[model samples]
Target: MIDGLKPYAEMKDSELCWLGDIPAHWRVKRAKAVLRRIDVRSSAGAEELLTVSSARGVVPRRTANVTMFQAESYAGHKLCWPGDLVINSLWAWGKGLGVSQHHGIVSTAYGVYRARDASGILPRYLHELVRSSPFHWELQVRSKGVWISRLQLTDESFLNAPLVVPPLDEQAAIVRFLDHADRRIRLAIAAKQKLIKLLEEQKQAIIHRAVTRGLDPDVCLKPSGVAWLGDVPAHWEITRLGRLIKLTTGFPFKSDGFTHVDDDIRLMRGINVSPARLRWDNVVRWPMSERPNFREYELIPGDIVLGMDRPIIQRGIRLAVVKEVDVPSLLLQRVARIRVRGDLNAEFAALLLSGRNFASYLAPIFTGISVPHLSPEQIKAFRLALPRAEEQQKIVEDVTVRTGAIRSAIDRAEREIELLREYRTRLIADVVTGKLDVREAAARLPDEVESAEPARDEFTADEESDPIEVDDEAEIEGVAG
Candidate 1:
């Protein structure tokens, strides 16, 4: 179906600059003409709570991370029925709105809209149309706020925005085509994700063996006393991480003092630390003039940075070794910078942290419900079975050489997944905006049983910088600008 897609034979100007030409037979209608803004309040907060996510659309609160809690008594929360459009008014610019598939209650801060009676718009079709790439620009430009992330899309603005109106039959066809494409894409991505998971597990097993049990299988083994460690080589030392390294928690730099100047020193927030990699994409900068005041927070090459908050995800522990390029960076609050105190190889320590053992140890002790966190003490308390300095260095080298191919394969799979996502994004935009006619292709698609798992897209997967959380105020609490 995807391969045979082509633009409609007859095209006409959409008049809307963002959407140039749509199918000639389709009508471009103002949103208000087809949607009625509804604000019905729940008599009692008895319905399941729902949240609007740019990644997952409207889903039940229990299915996603809960960033905030509801107040006592559910009375007066806004009511949302199945097929109703729920928009997190403050986050609409971020694609934080979608048509609900389940009836529930949402925060009062959200705007609920229903297709007007007799309006030809299909709920599923409108959901895709408004979330298409071009429509995101429409929401961003119409949203009002000083900070881009905080922009609020007023009810009137959304109601006045232009929407494409296809014939009911065509709308159904578009939805079917996109739905089928989505299912196929999900399966492809799942395969890649599974491969990555397997490769990671294999790589981790190698590291765990190298770190816990020395490279030589003939080496002597003895009870290590630590339950997680089980047994280790007789010559190895079992010690807390703090005994071998100096740990420094970041200083609390005021947000107002942060700058965007590239020449300024980069601030390494907890979010900047991903598993095995340091990400500077979302960094803040401290003024060069104020550099001398924060000498202790300065990060140097060979330092290992770890996110103290939500330190573990499904992928692995959040930690990375700093390289020469990562220098000129300062550690920010909730992140820890570690320096070897003696002969411990930094690479070996990183392997220990990145391995499954550290995560298992941290799992039972980490605190916080909405956001799990690691205190400096908790991180320092992790125990590890360490071999001699020479043995540690040798083990690191051997593991790196052995796992190189696995790492490459994981990278290739990740790149393929990225390409698939890009294709999906473009396909939705072209098909929904009428740049490509999917009706004919839709007709050719064979019957497919819908999977119980919701379709995962770029918005719903690893792409979100932060977990979108909802609180009593009906706001997405974890959005990062």
Candidate 2:
């Protein structure tokens, strides 16, 4: 839909450093001139609670996977209606602002704004424009704090920020063009994701077969008493994971001490673990001085860490193998580190934890409604049909060789999705910032039913930035605007 787009015919300087040249007809206005801050408090806190996320704008608090406790009374929380823009004042620079489509209540610390009656801005257009890269830079420059992580965007700063305004018709065109472009990009991403899923499923089948039935297809089967394992190789032994591996759950670290200092030891929270790899993005750190006090929590190469909280996500179980680069890291709460004890192969244990059977074993065992979790006991109690140590190593080696191509294919698909997302981000920035004219392209597009917006979890932050933490805002009563 964004093919062969061209620049505006005439242009003029916006004079705002953040927003450079704009179409000649466009006007630049202070955000306060175009938007009015609203602070209607919810009388009874009965409205649906909302949250502002960096990757997704304003959404229901229930949809967010937060571990924070909810306020007992939300009566004095800020009330917002459809088309209102909600900004996480504390994280505005992280792109934690979006125009809401639902009537809800937000954090008392959030700033809610609505377009003035006479303002020639569309909420949808504003949503895109503010979230663009240029606006992120503007917000970061205006925010105040001692450090980048704690930066806060005050009311005066947000109100004084310059806004690029296109004509009402042009704003609608921009919105339509970007929406169409997003739909196309999402569909492309979905296709790639589907391919990745199939490849992963195929790889899992190979691992499951090898681990369960062994390399010999015609081997004699025994009735494994475990309900999950119907039949295993006659020679295989069924034993609980605790018998072969030592499980260590992380210590309860204080969040107040969490730092962003690069040289400090990284606290390996659940967020840092993905399917088969550890993601250092969104890491929290502890002081190097305190590291000596928690020597037992230190991770080493070949350790297997699993996210006990929400262990199973759409992608897969959040289990990853610790590597050499991930050391100098201390395990944090809600993550489990498994180390080989007697004769189990670390890689083989990882295979079991990452396989489909383990996921099935865990599916029904998760306890908690808002944030499902697995107790260290539950994880240790998992029973696996095991082969002897040497045979386990042989199976791992054989499976690795067989699944190499499939893994490579999955990586390629993932990389393609990343590139598509990057392209979408660039397209939105260019279109909204007047670098590309999408009016003609929008007008030529056929009318179609817009698919439901993709779920927020499907997307990650544009950078390794902080996510919305409900506890960041105190449960204070909001005052009138």
Candidate 3:
């Protein structure tokens, strides 16, 4: 589309297939020609070992799985240096590759390779090339065995693979452009992540303020003397949960009671409870014969349900509100259904259950030898600071408005992230699969290549090295230190 390059569509088959058409002066080579394997063992000592994280790449070796404190000696581990490429042999398929920038050792499980000629082939460009789908497909096809769980790239296979080489200057320019684009995308992602965190924190702050202090801040206040809730509005009453609501446990429903029926009835389980909402995707239906016993467990549109599983409680489970589709839904035995009675507001009660104040109150009360649980009596007897019906509605309305805005922002940001990821994948596919020509694409770059000359020496394998053993104790000590 720009100048100095032609489209791949006009090129003949003899010119190129995988990379479309490139400059006639360009030559294709194998990855092994530019990468040299480095495998050397280190003594078992106190040297810090580095780990490769899928998200962070090569970081300080302290986080490796081996113990670092007790080992008396150090032996055999592969040494890595700055500009060297390290990859977990078992996880290479997942893109567990990193360009190291520090002097350290890696476990024997990782493969370390150095660029044979940095000027001839840019390391960054090669790294990006290997990650492309075309290169990965070649690796997959050359891999042995039906299952590629522990596949490693053989030297022969690596040497035989074809690479699309442009002039050295053009390769460097392409790398620069890609790095800039990648940095921009990463910054955008980080900004979105920070916004999501701020929204979440704001949501929690709103709930905490509303539950602890009534909608009318100018109202007379007093010390409730309760440690969990420091103080309450003077006019508000502190009452036990038993007095304000009805707490009941659901009857035991076995797997035999489940049925695949076209009915309105659904059985609510802990799995149905998700973050801030309910998921009925795999919900099971219950028979009508068992409906009466579950009447007390029947969830209403505004009722709040809590998981009674001790582990779930320990993991900080929050109460969820029910909807119309969940009206006929019956709760399982390990779930507690709380229904507001008299003049109490159901939405307000649900809000209290959803907030930090209620969670802080209930966290300590849950106790057990093996599995912690909350009894019906305990739920009923729990203390709560209650506001008048009018004030409760006001607090609920305020929280709904604030939290609704935050939820909407999170939803939109998540969608944008998805779109960006899709665009990145499509771009890579188009470039790597010959659907687009890199030479023509390079013409759209901000700068043109300074030279069309190729480097002198190509990549070649160095002398083979022996496998190294890593000290388990020193590795642990490094992490603990």
Residues 1-481 of candidate 3 have per-residue lDDT tens digits of 2123333554333243445554445567765777778887676544566766433356675333222232344456677887777776544554555677677767666778787865376666666666665556666665554334445655555556676655677666556555444554555665675676577668778888887787777877899878888888887888877888877666777755577575647877654653356656446678877688667777788778875543132112436788886667888776778888975788888766766766676667654333345677767766778888888888888888878978899779756765665665556544433344465345455643434322110100000000001110111112222
lDDT of 3 at 327: 69
- The better candidate by TM-score, 1 or 2, is 2
Worst 10 residues of 3 by lDDT: 459-468
lDDT of 2: 0.81
lDDT of 1 by residue, 386-450 (tens): 88889999999999999999999988987898798789889999888989888888888888888
Candidate 1 stretches with Cα past 4 Å from truth are 250-271, 279-298, 324-332, 366-371, 452-481
TM-scores of all candidate predictions against the true structure: 0.89, 0.90, 0.54
For candidate 1, the 10 contiguous residues with the lowest summed lDDT are 466-475
lDDT of each: 0.81, 0.81, 0.60
lDDT of 2 by residue, 215-318 (tens): 98799999988777679999988899999888899999887678888888998877677788787756779999899999999999999998876677666777
lDDT of 2 at 461: 29
Off by over 4 Å in 3: 1-27, 44-48, 61-75, 117-119, 139-162, 214-229, 232-398, 428-481
Among residues 3 or more apart in sequence or in different chains, the pairs in candidate 2 whose N, CA or C atoms overlap within 3 Å are none
